[model samples]
Target: MSGDGVFSSGVLSCLAALQRLMDGNPTVAQHVGLHRAKITAGIVSVEAGFDRGYLKKSRPAHLPILAKIEAARRSSVSSSISSTSSDVKRLKGKLRLLEDELATVLTQRDKVLTQNIQLWERVRELESAHRNSNAPELTTLT
Candidate 1:
């Protein structure tokens, strides 16, 4: 019974170490942990009725699967971030173009306002000339 307890503790320690190694990938780590639990259960069954050779043969298959799963997740995240970056750059370009168009419109508006002021000044001068021409003249009897 003591030997069995020691063996189980050793297996738990190994599982904890593997879990730590997979900290960067939580989802994959969870899957790996579940797989390890299943493997541990199978080892118990083997100790009860099967051989050690079977355990040795089955051990190497799942590590490669975990690595592949982690790689696919990394690629997916990489593509998403890159696409978002491109979208941000495109939006910034559009904003700059809008700013430039606003400046051009403001310049045109200033020119129109200047021309309107000049026209108003000309109208005022014409009114003043007409008023002077129509003034009554006083003549003295001689």
Candidate 2:
């Protein structure tokens, strides 16, 4: 096939079908028997009304289409990686905030516990002093 005539009706349709698949078009997804994440040359060809063997033959005419498909696949993979990285960063930030909050709550709890202990000690001492004062005076009969 001549370079100018490389994009026949079948090739054009295949490219269109690939774009639709990548864009998550539900109808195309159903026709191709695969979703965007699972797009392959065979599925694209089939969706374009070509047999699976059309792309498998690796004709020079198919180079451009194959290149486009590979590029799309690489783009999708990189985007997925970047999105996952962003998600990890967001989760790490949330975890740090929660850790800081937990530390603050623990400090407040320790302070409250110490105060309670001091108050209980003071109460016990006051009770002892009151008991001693109320005791009968010692008898000093000469």
Candidate 3:
């Protein structure tokens, strides 16, 4: 698909060349418009010549497997994207629940601390009262 000169890729160039060859537009190919003669000549040259290796007619056999491989790669990418998004949603939900529990625990801890302070103050008052009641009266000297 690159415009990197006419014959950059062999068959790739031939495909673009084919369009021009068939159009018969003078602007496209000047005078060498899609002649049945030229196409037949090219086909004959390819067939009669002994240059039979990669560019032969047998390569069409690979198209089906190629299509399947492309489909599978697309499917895997889409599934991975979905799974990653789901994991993020799950983590967000867990984070919210944990934050709620932490707040409740903090509130309960503050209440317990306040209760302990009040109990300590009551204990100090009770102990002082007991000492005062047990103390001997300051009687006048006889």
Candidate 4:
């Protein structure tokens, strides 16, 4: 095979190896260091049994593999962002529910306090009236 043909075959093999890693193939994952590190060009090259030097940016034949790696990285990042956004939304909903419950409890406490104050005032009035009714009558001696 010519140099271009060999590079093309190597590129195709690397792409296949990347796909296997993405698919969670255990053997491929271990071999490519996917289980311990992120999917990088060097890892993919190792998985495809290709030399890492061929993956340099100066090589036109290697550009496609690099592009594929970048695309996979972006895809994982966007998915992670979306999942984090969903978690934030869920937590916000829980916080709103807790705040509402607290408001309800505070309202009930205020109502009970007002009722207690009113009962205390009524008891004081009754005590004053009882004291006045029990007062001894004054006798005037001429």
Candidate 5:
């Protein structure tokens, strides 16, 4: 059966999906089913022709439609994987840049804090010197 002009199971499964779609249409379901039967009959007729030597060929035709579909699916999956990898790399680079920016801002904050502390200490020293210079002077009793 595999070597004959019969469709693979996968092709039949696809046809079943189409049948499900047709079943949902209440008005045209019967007509669609009839149409599908007619199409199946046509395919069988063609297969019979090929079998009876009505159609001569050097080699039998191999309709690997399902295999082709699977290959396309695999190609799409690989493409999406590569796209996701690039997106991750881009996000990591942005994160690194943000971290560097944060470090620079923190360094600037520490420098400003140090300068403020030094300025406050100088003010205290000046006040202490002023108070010491304003003390009462000792006078000579002659």
Candidate 6:
């Protein structure tokens, strides 16, 4: 489609994408499925009108409706992307909090283990001292 926005598969996608970006409407972006920069080159051909390009010319009348459709599509798409991004950010924050908690727990475990080891060593030393001290001396019988 030319300025009118009537197009088949490839042309329609290109046009639709351009329509989305230039329009910056979420509804169109959703339908087009990409960002604005990506659509720019494709729109170059469209800016010239379909008559200048390989694709057949879309009538001028269709442009306004197509633009409207693209606008709505882009608007919805933008909305979805914005919401999804916000969700991802929230999830990332939660993940960071969990990781911090995990680290704290691991450090506590290490400290407890060290304390246990020290206690066990002290007990062994005490038991050995008691055995040596309590043992009776033996004299050899001739």
Among these predictions, the greatest TM-score belongs to 2
Query: What is the alpha-carbon lDDT for the whole of candidate 1?
Result: 0.52
Off by over 4 Å in 4: 1-4, 26-37, 51-54, 102-142
The TM-score measured for candidate 5 stands at 0.45
Per-residue CA lDDT of model 4 for 74-108, tens digit only, reads: 88888888989999999999999999999999999
Indicate whether candidate 2 or candidate 3 has the larger TM-score. Answer: 2
Kindly list the per-residue Cα lDDT of model 5 for residues 41-127, writing each as its tens digit: 223223333232222123233234323334444665677789899999999999999999999999999999999999999989976
Of candidates 5 and 3, the better by lDDT: 3
Arrange candidates by lDDT, descending: 4, 2, 6, 1, 3, 5
Which regions of candidate 3 fall more than 4 Å away from where they truly are? 1-59, 135-142
Clashing pairs in 2: none
Off by over 4 Å in 5: 1-63, 135-142
Model 6 segments beyond 4 Å from truth?
A: 1-57, 135-142
How many residue pairs clash per model? 0, 0, 0, 0, 0, 18
lDDT of 3 at 37: 29
Candidate 1 vs candidate 3, TM-score winner: 3
Q: Give the winner by TM-score: 2 or 6.
A: 2
Local error of candidate 1 at residue 73 (angstroms) = 3.7
Kindly report which residue pairs in candidate 3 clash with one another. none
RMSD of each: 14.1, 7.6, 19.5, 8.6, 15.3, 9.5
Measured on C-alpha atoms, candidate 3 has an lDDT of 0.52
Question: In model 2, which regions exceed 4 Å deviation?
Answer: 2-7, 29-37, 127-142
Per-model TM-score, in order, reads 0.44, 0.71, 0.49, 0.60, 0.45, 0.46
Root-mean-square deviation of Cα positions for candidate 5 versus the true structure, in angstroms:
15.3
